[model samples]
Structure formats: C-alpha cells, structure tokens
Target chain A: MSKPETPPAPSCSQLFWVFTRIALTSFGGGVSGWLLREFVQNRKWMTQEEFLNGLSISQALPGVNVKNMAVWIGYRLLGWRGAIVGFVGIIVPPAIIIVLLGTIFSSLSRYALTHVALTGAAAAAVGLSLSMGITAARAVPRKAVPIAIMAGTFIAVALLHWPLFWVVLAAGLVSVAYAYARAS
Target chain B: MSEIPHTSLLLSLLAVFAPLSLVTIGGGQSAIADINRQVVDVQWLSQAQFVDAFAISRMAPGPGSLLVTLIGWQVAGFWGAVVATLAIFGPTTFLIYAVAHMWSRNGGARWKRALETGLRPVAAGMILASTYVLLQAIDGGWFARAVALASTATLLLTKVNPLLLIGAGVVIFVGLHAISLA
Candidate 1:
C-alpha cells in the first residue's frame, strides 16, 4: 500500500537544533547511525531510501561524510538555508568544545597520566575507525579491478608511504576509468 | 612561518586545510596521514604535538578532523581556531551542497553514478591505509594494540557504545601502570 500523505517540512531552526544536539551528544563516534535514527526513523523527516542514497553519495564524494550527509539531508528537507543549518549544526558546537578541551590539555601537559589516558582513548578509537573500513570494504563489488585498486591504495599509503594526493589521484583515475569502460 | 603576522597565519591555516577537505572522503579518516604530513611540513606543530592533538580530537566529540582546530589554537589563538575550522570545513561545504542540489533536482544521472561507483574503491583503500598509519603511531605497545583489536571486534560484532570501550581502555592502561610500579 502506498502512503498517501507526506510529512510537513521541519523549520530551519528545528533542523539546526536537531543537528546541533546530535553533534553535541554523539560521543566516541557513530554519528551516521544517530543521523539515520533521527531523520529516517524518529522524525520521519527523510525516508530510509533517501537517507541511504545520500549516505552513499556522501561516502563516495570528497569532504567529511557526516557534513555531506548533513547537507544532503538538510537540502532535501528545506533547501539551501537548510543545508547551511545542517553544516553549522553538525560542526560549530563541537568545534567550540574541542578547542576548550585542547586548551585544558595544553596546561595539563605536564602530567604523564594525561598522555596515558589519551593514548588509551586513541587506541580504542581505532576500533571505531577499523570497523568503518571493514564496512566500506565489504561494499565493493566482487570483481578484480575494484579489489586491486583497494589493495594498491592501502599499500601505497600505508606500507610504501606514498603521498595521499598522488595515490588517490592515480588510483582514482584508474578505478574510474575502469568503471567507465565496464559501464559502456 | 611562526613569525608571520596573525592574519597571514590564519590565511595559511585556511589554505592548508581547504584543499585537504576535498580529499577527506570516507568519513575523514582517509585524510589524517596527509594532514599530519602537511602540519609537519608547514611547521605548524611538532610531530609529538600533532599526535597529542590527534588524541585529543579522538577523545573529543564531533568529527576527528577537529584536530585542525586544536592545531590552530596551539599555533595561534582564538581566531586561529576559527580560521582553521573554516578552512578545513568551508570549501568542501560548497562541493557537497552542489552535489546535493543536483542529485535531488535531476534524480540519479549517469555521471553521478559513475562518480559514486568510481570512488568507492579509492575510499576503501584510503581508510585501510589511514588505519595502518594510526596503528603504528598509537601508544601502549602490545597492550594498546590488543585493546584496539578487541575494540574493533566488539564494534563489528556487538552493539556496545564506543565511549565505554575507550573508557575501559583508559582504566586498563592505568591499572597496568599501577601494577608495573608496584
């Protein structure tokens, strides 16, 4: 059964505050999931398909995925202004806090324990990062060229220590060329 | 570079971070190694201080790329932070905005598909590479490595919150330190 009614659009401030709240509350990462729950499930502001589509585009494009996603959702719901709200909501509040924390950490730099706690936190955060990589890797199609590009990229950047600009540019050219040929 | 006037330093931060923003695909992790390199090359911060900033960014809320904000503050002051933040985040904002606009209006064009499909592998590769670099740079030796691996597993397999895992890591390291001292 097709649904007959679409939900009314949320105001720009409503959009901004939601993003700001998510930015403020999301600790230790997983912001994308939070976004999905808020827009797709909780408020029904955006459909699941729309959210997923925006997510894929955000992931594939340059720039921060969350910021892109925020803009994507905001633009869809409201327009240009909504997009700006999304950007500010997701970034500004947290930027302020991180700077404050940095200030405190600088003064507390003498303590060995501060560094130790930071190290521990950093290590555990790797779990979040690696898990994300695995998820992305699994999304690649089962084919030789894509797999090769992925592996080549890792080697160039990680093992070989090639500069990222060159690696991404070179590998992206090859990968996109291959996709273009395959498409035709 | 440090001796440059305030406005100039702010511009340089904007310059450094703006281009890096375009390369920060796949959740911003892919850009960290390059960002570290740029920060080092520019003499904005020392390697040790950069790592410290990275740690602080990870520990703080919001995007990990906030490391630049921390970097700016360390190098200059309040406006430095604002400028660095804008530099890192502003240019790319236009990009995604344009893409978002076109996507909704046109609805799944061929080039769009090509771009998304083409970039996926590169994004994946970059994430893996950045993860490796981070692994090499973090502290606590084997214990740190173990926690990272275990945390990875838990995240992949379970629904536990990441903050809890990071807190547990801090507690474990502190406990280990106390035992070694005794």
Candidate 2:
C-alpha cells in the first residue's frame, strides 16, 4: 500500500547533491540500487511503484541507466530545472575526478605493481557489472517468448558481437508486439 | 608544436562519439566493444593506452562511459575531454527527457504497458551481454575471473559495500604477488 501523504518535493539543490553523492560514492556501479534506496526508502519522494516504473523506463531507453534515472527522478520531482540539475550533478563532479585519476594513474603506469593492483580492482569491479546483469535478467518476465528473446539477445551481442542498436531494435519491436498482442 | 589540428581533432572526437551516443542502449557499457575498435584498432591510441584508459574507467567513480572522456583527454587535452563527454552523453538526453515527460501524464494505455513490459527482456539481455564482454576483456588471467565471480556471488547474497570488495581485491592481489616473489 502507498503512503497516505506524499512527501514534499525535494529542492533542486537537494536533488543535485543527492545525485552528486551517488555519482561520487558509487565505486563499482549499482547506481540504480543507490537511487532506489535514496529516493524511495530514505527520502520517500516517490513511492516504490513509481520508482520501479521510472527504472524500467530508464533501462529501456538509450543512454546510461543511472543518468536516465537521475533525469527521470529530477523531472518527476522538479520539472525541467530538476532534470538539468540531475544531469550536471551526476556527470560533472565525477567527470573531473576521472580525468584527475587518469592523469595520476598514467604517470604511475610504469610500475608493474600499479597495473597488478588495477587489474585486481578491475576484476572485482566486473562483479558490479555481472551482479547488475544478473539482477536485470531476473527481472525479465518468465515466459517462453520473452525468455527466448532474452537468450537471442545475449547470443547476438555477446557471442556474435552484433551491433547493439539493431539487436535492441529487432528484439524490442518483437517483444513489444508480442506483449501488445497478448495485452488485447 | 601545434601539429595536431585543434578543430579537426575536436570535430573527430565529436564524430566518433555523437552517433554512438544514440545507440547506447541498456546503458553505456554496451558501447565498449565498438569504442575499443574505434580507439584501438583505428589507431587513435595504442593497445597499451587503450587498456590503461579502460582500467581507469572501470576503477573511476561515476559512469563507465567516462572512458570516452579519458580517451579524449589522452588524444586532445582539455577540449577533447569536453567534446567527447558531450558527444557520448548529449544526444540521448533529449530522448529520455521527452519520454519521462510523456510518462508523467497519467495513462493506463495498453501500448504504454506493452512498451514497458516488452523492453524488459531486451534490457536484461544487453546488460548481461555487456558484462560477458567485459569479463573476457579483463586481464589478470584466472585470478581476475575468480575475484569477479566471488564478488558477484557476494553482491547477490549480501548487502556488503562494493568499494570494500574492490579494496580487498587490491590487497589480496598485492599480497599474493609479494608471496610469489618471496
């Protein structure tokens, strides 16, 4: 059941700081999980159902899911201004850090140990991607057609290395059509 | 020496990433393979440089797509970073924003539900596919694979922070390396 009273909308500055924190603190992905916790569980700016709907839309759309999500949450809370704040907050701060980190690491690149450490870190980081993937896969509907589409997509992109645009377009259209037909 | 044509270099960065921007479905991770080809195979950066940048992207905070920003910086200094960042993250901003706007309107329209439900599997698959590609590309051999797998299992079963896991990875690898030398 939903809360009886909605929480007051977050200020654009509040929204910006939240996204900036998520972008800055999230080391190994799962930014979406961070978003869910921040907005739904903590702030209660939006209900769980509302958050999930926006999440699905974020995942389905092109661009970074978290960035799309920041924009979505921003738009929902504070219209166009909120969206821009979300975008800049999520991107700008971290962009500077990455460039700084890159410069520092490139200088340290001569050491074999530097690479070994990064390699280990990178490997662990893959866990973020893999776990996120497994979570997403689990969210897919449990039907033969949808399952097959999911499998076909995995094979095309991972195994065969097909372009993602076409794969998504083809699979998305078919899946959407199937859902549409079954809906009516 | 001002050998590198500033305008053309910036334009080239834009050209490379702008179109890729629109096609980055299931998040920016999905674009890595093409990016590797364009940046490495096409000779913008050598394989060593590409690998370094890739590792930096993975290790860095924020979006993994910031890899493009790093590549641009390596290729063309400050301006390259700006252009590449815009190219990758710019075009799709409008599309998602518009959809979010449309989504705000109350609707139980059949097509809306269908669109949401239909895209789920595709997005799931793409995320998995990108993960697989990343696993293959990573270095450190079997050790890396094991760390990744353990980390994945830990993430799924527990609510432990991922930064801790990454730190453990660094400590473990360095420890193991020291022991090997001794």
Candidate 3:
C-alpha cells in the first residue's frame, strides 16, 4: 500500500522534549487528555479519529494507558526511534523526581506531622483510585455475565484475598471468551 | 533484610513486577493490590511505608506506576529503583508496540473488538478491588476515610483540581491536629 507522506516528522529530540514537557507538567490524572490536546489540537500531528483509535487500543491492552498512547503516537509519526523516545521521555524525568521526593520524605519520617500529612495525601489518593474504579464500572456493559464477572473479580481479589494474577487471568479469559463468542 | 544479597534483591524485584506488568489490564493502578501483597510478603516494605509510597506516587507527576520505582528506591536505593522501573514498564512496552504495528491492518476486527469490550469488566472489577484494599490499608481512622470519601465525591461531581483536594485534605488533618493539641 503506497501512502502519501506530507510534512516531515519531528526530530527525535523534538519528540523527546514534547513528551518530557507533557509528563513533567501533568499533575494529578488526565495525562491522556494532555496528549490529545498537544498532538491533535495544537500540533495537528494526527487527526482526532486516529488518536482516539490509539486511545482505545491503549486502554484495552495491558500497560498504562498514557504510556501506551505515547508509544502509539510516537510510532505513528516516527517509527521505532520515536516509540523509544516517547517511552523514555515520559518515564525517566518524573521517575527521578519521585525518587528525590521519596528521599526527602524519608528524611522527614521522624516528624509526627510528616506521617499525618502523608496520611491525608493518601486519603485523597484513594479517591483517585475509587473515582477511576467507578468510571470503569460505569463503562461496563449493562448485562448479566459481564456484571457477574466484575463482581466475582472484586470478590476474589478484595474479599477472598486471592492472588490477583490468577483472578485476573481467569476472569479476563472468561470475559473475553464470552465476548468473542457473542461477536461470532 | 540486609542479609539478602544485592543481586538477589534486584532479581526479586524483577520477579515481582515483571509478571504483574502484563496483567496490569486497565492501568498500573490495577496491579497495586498484588504489588502490595508481594512487597509485604517479602518484607520489603511495611504497610505504612507502602501507603506512603502510594501517596508519594500520587503526588508526583508522570505515570502512577512509578510507585514501583519508589518502592524499589525505598528497598534498595538507586539500583532497586532501576530494576523495579524496568520490570514494571518494560514488558508491556513490547506488548503494546507489537500491537501497534498490527493495529493499522484491517484483519481481526472482531477479535480486537471482543478483546477491548471483554476486558472492560475485568478491568473495572480489578480497579474497584484495589480501591477496597487501599481503603483498608490506610492507617488513619474515620476522619481519613471521610476525607477519602469526600474526595471521591468531589471528583465525581465536579471538575475541580485534584491537587486542590489533596491540599485541603492536608490542611484539614493538620488543622484538626492542632486543635486536638491545644
């Protein structure tokens, strides 16, 4: 299939810096949203439909959605080097910051307020997790089998204290198989 | 814990995170429960330390899965962080990259749709379960739980900045602490 290429891809360094800025500037959630704005809205690197297609695949596949989206976008534009640049740019800088923060907090671990502040932050962080859970739950189809699988997964992992690996494997296989059968 | 050799510690980090990488269906958040379980079992981090790492990861920018990196740093410093980060993120990079190559092709549309829709329920369940585990793991009493619930409500109901919510949480707790001290 011959494809027309218009406008050259950004240099690998440019791609790296773009991803780095996105990663460093993103606070709280919504990294994917930032990706959409930068790539589709501002840069016009890809169309909205193309980005959304990558977004869905990114979400469905195992891995972090934002990171997957980065790789997908990078690959779409610049091939292998772009993908590698995207992955490293998004992951490395903030990783160093996390370590630094962890060091600073560990030093202050002796203070009573340190624990208290962390506790507060953690409490709020749980909301982040819970909100994501609720959103995911709402997206599930309103049907019996899928709902049952979801409930069962919750039970096995949370209540029963079963190993998450086995629980995810079993539930995922069953659910995917069902969906596949239905689609046939 | 100190008696464990350096190479073994790195290897252990790999063993724990690499497998969990592929199974992280929805996101890195989905694997937290297992990460918590394994880290605790190995005595790499106490529950409190794990929770602290979780909070720090939340507060830090970039991917939340960097929680694994923080865990590694806490456990064995720089080398630990390096191993853990690579383990958690590396496996899935290959998986997603390969998929991206094939995704442009028109074949296997039905299977692709099935995989996407089928995984949604399981991902939802895992995320909720992880939330349940975290809610239980937190050390703060009712007040903390209340704050978490309030944050969740706020997030769902409004488009407020989560950083603001977290700051409010800190102020509320510290302020209440000051009153109790007085």
Candidate 4:
C-alpha cells in the first residue's frame, strides 16, 4: 500500500517543539482536541482522517492515551526520529513542570488559603473530569451487550474495587472477542 | 518510617509503575486506583499526600499522569521523579511504536478494527470510573461537588475557557466563605 506522503514533514526538533507547545498549553484536559487543531487544522502535516485513526488506536492501547497518540502521530509523519521526539517531548517537559509545581504547592500547603484555593481549583478540575466522563458515557452504543460491558467495567473498577489489571483483562478480552466474532 | 535506600526506592518505583503501564489499558488515568493502592500499601506516601499530588497534577499543564512524577519527587527527589517518569511512560513506548508500525502497515485489518471497536466502550467505562473515584476522594464537601457540577454544566453548555472556570471556582469559594463570616 502506498503511503499518502505528507509534504513538508517535521524534523525531530519541530516535532518536539510542536508537541511541547501542545503539552504546555493544553490544560484542564482535552489534549486530543488541541492536537487535532494543531496538527490537522493549522499545520496540515497530517490529515484529519489519519489523526483520528491515531487517536482511536492510542485510546485502545495501553499507557497514556495522549502519550501514545504523540508517538503514533510522530511515527506517521517522520519515522524513527519522530517517534523518539514524541516520547521525550510529551513526557519530559511536563514532568519537570509538575515537579516544580509540586515544590511550590508543597510550601503553600501549610497555609489555609492554599488549601482553600487548591480545593476550588481541584473542584473545578473534577468538573472537567466529570464532563469528560459524561462525553465518554454518551459515546457508547446503546446496544445491550455493549452497555452491559460498560456497566460491568464501571462496577468492577469503581464500586467493587477490583484490581484494574484483572478488570481490564477480563473486560477487554470479552469485549474484543465479541467484536471480532461479530465482525467475522 | 524506615529509611529505604535510594536504589531500593528507585527500583521499587520502577517496578510498581512499569507493570502498571501495560495494564493502563485505556489511558494513564485508568491506572489511578492501582497506583493509589500500591503506593499506599507500599507505604511510600499517605492518602492525604496522594490526594494532594492528584490535585497538583490536574492543575498542572500536561497530562494528569504527571502525578507519578510528583509522587516520585515526594518519595525521593529529582532522580526519583525522572525515574518515575521513565518508568510509567518508557515501558509503553515500544509497544505503541510496534502497534503504530503495524497499524499503518496493515490499515483497517481485522485485529485493528477489533481492537478499536472492542475497546471503545471499555475505555469509556474506565474513564467514568476514574471520575467516580476522584469524586469520592475530593474535599470541600458539598460546595466542591456543586462547583464540580456547575463546571460540568458550563463545559457542556458554554465555550468558556476551562482555566477561567477554574479561576471562577476559586473566587466563588472564597466569596462564599466571606459571606458566611459576615
């Protein structure tokens, strides 16, 4: 199969800088939305179809979805060097900032106001998470089998407090197997 | 607290997080519970500290999984933070590369469709579950919960910037507290 060559491919540094910008500026979640707008819309380095495919696979695979996506997008555009840049760019800069912020917040943790402010910040953050959850919930097919699988997964992890590994394994296997069988 | 050797802490942080990487199934967030359990069970940090770390990561720019880096820093120091970042993100790097390689090579293959189609609902469920866990652990009582709901509504309804909403939350909470005092 001939690859649809993307003109004006990004170099490792370009990939790093682009991903770094996305990582730093993307806050309160929706990193994927940011990625789409940057790479597909503004840059045109990758098409929308290609980007969405990478996102789906990224979400399906293990590890951080956004991190996985960076690698997938990088690999699609620039091969080996691009992949390395994606991994480093996404993980390193953010890790540094988080550690620094952790330091600052630790000092502030002593104050009642810090706790209060952080509480408000956190409350708002939880809203982002909840909204995301609502979006995810709405995405599921209304079919009974899929709905049941979704509910079962929620119960095992959220309510029963089963270990994530077992729950993912059992649920993922059953769901994937069902999908494969249905497709066949 | 027993003084764990530097090497021992690094190795254990690597051990705990590396394996969790594979089972991260949907995304980094899905592993939060096991992370919570293992870190606490291993006596690396207290529950309150972990909750604080979660909040800091959520507020910080970048992926929320940076909580691991903060955890590592709290547990040991700079090197610990580096090691933890590598541990969590490093392990899955190759797996994704290989999958991406094959995915682009194969294009719309059976397993690809199966993996994509099959995992969608599972991913959604895990995300929802993580949100549930976070809600259960949050502080500030009903006010926080209400703040969360209003934030959700605003996100769903308006195109308002999330950073602004977060700032608004801070103001609302502080304002309400002042009114109570008066």
Candidate 5:
C-alpha cells in the first residue's frame, strides 16, 4: 500500500498576512478560539485535530495562547521566517493601539466625561473576565481531581486571601501529585 | 505638568517590560497579578489607574498585555508609550522567534510534548488565580457585582462580541452619570 503524502505547507507570506489579519481584528477576548475557528476550521490551514494539539501545546508553553499559536503555526507553515512574520503580526496591532490610546488618554485625563466612560468600561471588564473564567473552567478535563484542585484553589485565594504565589505553588504540587497517583 | 525626559521614560518603560517579559514565561496576561502587585501595591501606579488601563486595553483590539503601554503613557507621555510598547514586545518576540526556529529544526521532539503537559495545568491555575484576585479588587458595590454577573452570563450564553458588551456598559455609565448630574 502507498503511504499518504503530507499536505503542502502554507507559504510564509500567506501565513504572515492571515495571522496579521487575526491580530489586527481580534477584539475583546478569546482571541485564541477565534483564531482556531478561522485558521483551522474555516480556512483549513490546519486540521481540527492538529489545531487542538497545537492549542494544548500552546497553552502549556509560557506565552499567550494566541502568540504561542502564532509562533507554532508560523513555524509549521514556513519555519523561522513564518515565525517572525507571525510574531510581528501579533504584536504590531496592539502596539499601535496602545500608542494612540496613550496619546489620547493623557489629553483626556482631566475630563469628567472620560472618567464616567472609564467607570462603565471597568464594570464591563469585570463582567467579561468573569465570563472568561467560566468558559475556561468548563474546559478543564471533567475529572474529580482537576475539579477539586480548581475549587480548592478558588477558595484558598478568593475566600482566604492567600498570596497568589502560594496558591499557584500549592495547586501545582497538588496537580502533580494527583497525576502521579493516577499513573501508578 | 512637565514632560518626562525621553531617556527616563524609556528607562522606566524598559524597567517595566523587561522584567515582565522575562518573568512572564507563560505570556504577559499571566503576569498580570504580579504586575499589579509590583505596580499598584508598590505605588508604581494606583489601583484605579491600573484598572483604567486594563479596561482600555480590553476595549481596544489586539493583546491584553498592551496595557503596559497605557501605564507607561500615564507615567510619562507619548515617547514613554512608544518605548514601553517596544520594550515589552521586542524581547519576547525575539525569544519566541529563536525558540520556534530551534523547535522546527529538532523534528518535533518529545521534550516539547512533556513541557506542554506540565505547563497546561499551571497556566490554567494561574488564570483562575488571576481571576480571583481581580474579583477581590473590583468587588465593592451591588452595581459592580451586577454588571459583572450580567456580562459573564451574556458571555456564557451567547456569541455576542465583547466589544458590544463594553459599549453597552459605557452607555449605561454615561446614562447613570447624566442622571446623577440632573
């Protein structure tokens, strides 16, 4: 039997521009989900299984999922050139926005209207964050161990006001132990 | 008020982003609690100011980490914003590029998979922890709690874009402000 051939990789320039569009337009939150839908599901830039695998790896790495995805996808597409293009695409739009907002916000600082708008924005941000938390919690493998870790950590930090570092360290140790116990 | 010297502004921007870039091993957003501890509690910026920058960053497009630029802007000015933006992204970008290059050449190794498996839970826990911290900081009144709850519900129930929610909140705030003025 003949072996199936791996599909041709996307060109560096194509990957660069596609990621650029994602970076420029992905507003408000869950950019990673949006990215997956667009690049993997819709465009078939990657298969769904590959995207999920990429996501798992991206989340496990030490960067924003979107940025990490960009890097991984870039590397997958055209090696190093693709990676650079993806990184630039990811950062450039936000940099521009920040610069412009920085200029405008300073000039508008003393305005009462500005403060009112900001207050509303803050309220919305809190809501958005809460929503993000719920979505993320839903994604954790629905197992007793992970759930317990989640609940315990939430209580430890939210109710008891433990330092963040300690909460993270404690959760990490517990998770590792749980995994170890399960394996053996 | 005088403009901060360009050099000092640049130095401060670097000061903020350089450490954040390195320590943010998992991404800039994950470093938020740490950033808040260092900036807000340490008096680099006030709590309200941090909240303001964060809100603005979320409202706008692109990465959440870009809030560092707003903080820089508040501390200094235009030049500071530019420098801070570059400082924050520049090093991280370079590092990611180099790492990607190496990973690609290595023909997809098992070490990468191991690293991913380890970091997954840690990143998730960090996000959960950050959420809790933010909740504590922002929880004050019924209105705030209500808004948060409503937003969360909307996010969970529908595919409505967050910008719409943010815009609606702005409108509500303005309306409330107008009523109070009256």
Candidate 6:
C-alpha cells in the first residue's frame, strides 16, 4: 500500500498552547465532544474520519480517552514534540486543581455545606456511573461470547463479590484464548 | 503550609499510582474497583472517605479520575497529592503518546481493529463492575437507595445536567434533615 504523504506539521509550541487552552476549559463532561468540534469539525486539523479512527485507537490503548486523544491530536498536528506538549497540557490543569481542592477539602470536612454537598454529589456519582455504563454497554458488539463474558464478569464482581483481580484475570485469559482460537 | 515528608509521600504516591496506571486499561471508572481495594480495603481511606473524595471529584471540573489527587492528599498531604497525581498519570501519558504515535503511522489495520473489538467489551464490563462496587460502598439506607435509584432513572430517561441532579439530591437530603426526618 502506498503511504500517504504527511502534511506540514504544526510547531510544537503551537500544539502545546492549543492543548493548554483546551485543557483549561475542559471541565466536567463533553471534553471529548468539544475536542471533536474544535479540532476536527471547526479547525480541520484532522478530518472526521481521522478523528474517529484516532478515538478508537486511543480508547483501545491504556489511559484516559481525553488525554490519549490529546496526544494523538498533538502528534497529528506536529509529531513527537506535539505528543509531549499535548500530554503535559492536558494533565497539568487537573493536577493543580485537585491539589488545591484537596488542601481546602481536608479543612472543610466539618462544614455543613460541604458535607451536604458531598453527600448529594455521591448520590449523583452513582447516576453518572450508571449512565456511563449504559453508554458503554450499547457499544458492545452483538456477539454471544463477548456478551456472555460481560454478564459473567458483572455477576462475578457484583453479586459473587469475587476479588477483582481474579475476575479480571479470568476474563482476560478467556477472551484471549477465545480470540486466538477463532483466529486459528 | 506544613512540610509533607517526601519519602512517605513518594512511597504512597507510587503505591497508588503504580497499580492504578497499569490496571486502568479501560479508563477512569475502570480504576475504581482496584482503587477500592487499595484505598478502602487496605485501610488507606475509609469507604465514606472514598465516597467524599469521589463526590468532590465528580462535582469539580476536570477528569473524574483526577479525584486520585484528593485520595493522595488524604494519604499524605498537599505535596503528596501533587506527587501521586503526577505519578499516576505520568507513565500512562507517555504510554498513550507512544501508542498514538504508532497508531497514526499505521492508520487503520487489522490488529488494531481486533484489539479495539476485544477491548470494547472488556471496558464495558469493567465499568459495570465499578458501578456495582460503588453502589455497595454507598449502602446507606432506604432514602439513599431511593435517591440513587431515582438518579439512575433520571440519567437514563432525561438529558438533565448531572450537577443539577446532584443539587436535587442535596436539597432532598437537607430537607429531610431540617424536618427532623433523619
């Protein structure tokens, strides 16, 4: 297959600054969608097709999707330098915010407002997590073996109270064997 | 600002980050189950404390997993939080960079596609498991259970902002408290 010629790379500094801006603003949900809108749709740094491809690759690889996506976007915009700047840019804001909050939070634990707010937020965390789970579940390919694995893992961890390590290890081994067997 | 011991802070940071970085194959929530083990079961933090940190993380702007910083702080202090947050994300960030670089170069290929196919279901399963574990940890009472169930329903049925739902839960809880309803 003929390799497509790479486009002119953006400067590392440009990539760094762009990602820094995005990281600063990407609070709460919708960060990924926002990145898609800005980088792919509006800026045309990468085509929609390329963005989707990159998203899948990022999700498959370890790490947060937003951070991974940032790295990929930076690399696409530049190269190795782009990757470093993008990673650092995405990570730094959250790190700083959490540290600051941590300091205040320890002191404010006795405050009524903080206590009530945290309790409520905990309830909502469950909802957010369930929503995430539902969304992820929809993405599972309609296959018997995979579905079975999903159900089994859920039951094992949720109902059986099996240690997570054992459950994950078993599922991983089974999935790998199944994939290899099918391939052969 | 009290000086946090660097060695204890560094050790705790590594203890939290090493397992979290390696095992968070799916993403933020996927790390929760392991985090529960390390933080709660290991007595690094109590279950309620974990809930508090998680709540704060959810309410705050940024990645959900960024709550790890708060957990780090609880284990050590300000510097500990910073170190743990950095350590947790550092290797994973580099790994993502390397993988993204190779992936862009290769473009769409069979192996990549196969990996995606395998990982998607696994990630889904991990998310479900994490949700279950969280629900168990937050086992309060009928009121709490009702709130959780209602919140889950609202999330599934409506497009309301999560922060708003969180606010509603707080209002209801406070109302109950004020009225001497426990």
Q: Judged by TM-score, which candidate is best?
A: 3
**Candidate 6 or 5, higher TM-score:** 6
lDDT of 2 by residue, A88-178 (tens): 9998899999999999998998998887787777778778778877887898889999999989988998899776667777998999999
Off by over 4 Å in 5: A1-12, A41-43, A141-148, A151-170, A173-184, B1-29, B76-125, B136-140
- Clashing pairs for model 1 are none
Per-model TM-score on C-alpha atoms: 0.93, 0.88, 0.96, 0.92, 0.80, 0.87
Residue pairs clashing, model 6 = none
First chain of candidate 4, TM-score? 0.91
Candidate with the larger lDDT of 1 and 5: 1
Q: Please report how far candidate 5 places residue B96 from its true position, in Å.
A: 5.9
Q: Score the docking of each candidate (DockQ).
A: 0.72, 0.66, 0.82, 0.69, 0.43, 0.53
Task: Give the least accurate 10-residue stretch of model 2 chain A, judged by summed lDDT.
Answer: A1-10
Docking quality band of candidate 4, CAPRI definitions: medium
Query: What's the DockQ of model 2?
Result: 0.66
The ten-residue window of minimal lDDT in model 6 chain A covers: A1-10
Q: What is the C-alpha lDDT of each candidate?
A: 0.84, 0.84, 0.90, 0.83, 0.68, 0.73
What's the CA error at residue A159 for candidate 2, in Å? Answer: 2.9
A1-184 in candidate 1: lDDT tens per residue?
6773688899988999999999888876788899999998889987888899999888888888888889889999988889999999999999999989998998888988777777877888888888888988998888999999999999998888787877888888888778876765
Candidate 6 C-alpha lDDT tens digits along A14-95: 6777777776666546677878987766666777778888888777766777777887888777777777788877777767
Clashing residue pairs in candidate 5 are: A62-B25, A62-B26, A63-B26
lDDT of 6 by residue, B1-182 (tens): 65866696578668667656654656777777768767786687887788878877777666777878788777877776777777667767778777766765664465665667666677788788888778777735666767877888888898777778887877877676667744
Chain B TM-score of predicted candidate 5 relative to the true chain B: 0.82
For lDDT, candidate 4 versus 5, the one ahead is: 4
Worst 10 residues of 2 chain B by lDDT: B1-10
User: Order the candidates by lDDT, highest first — what do you get?
Assistant: 3, 1, 2, 4, 6, 5
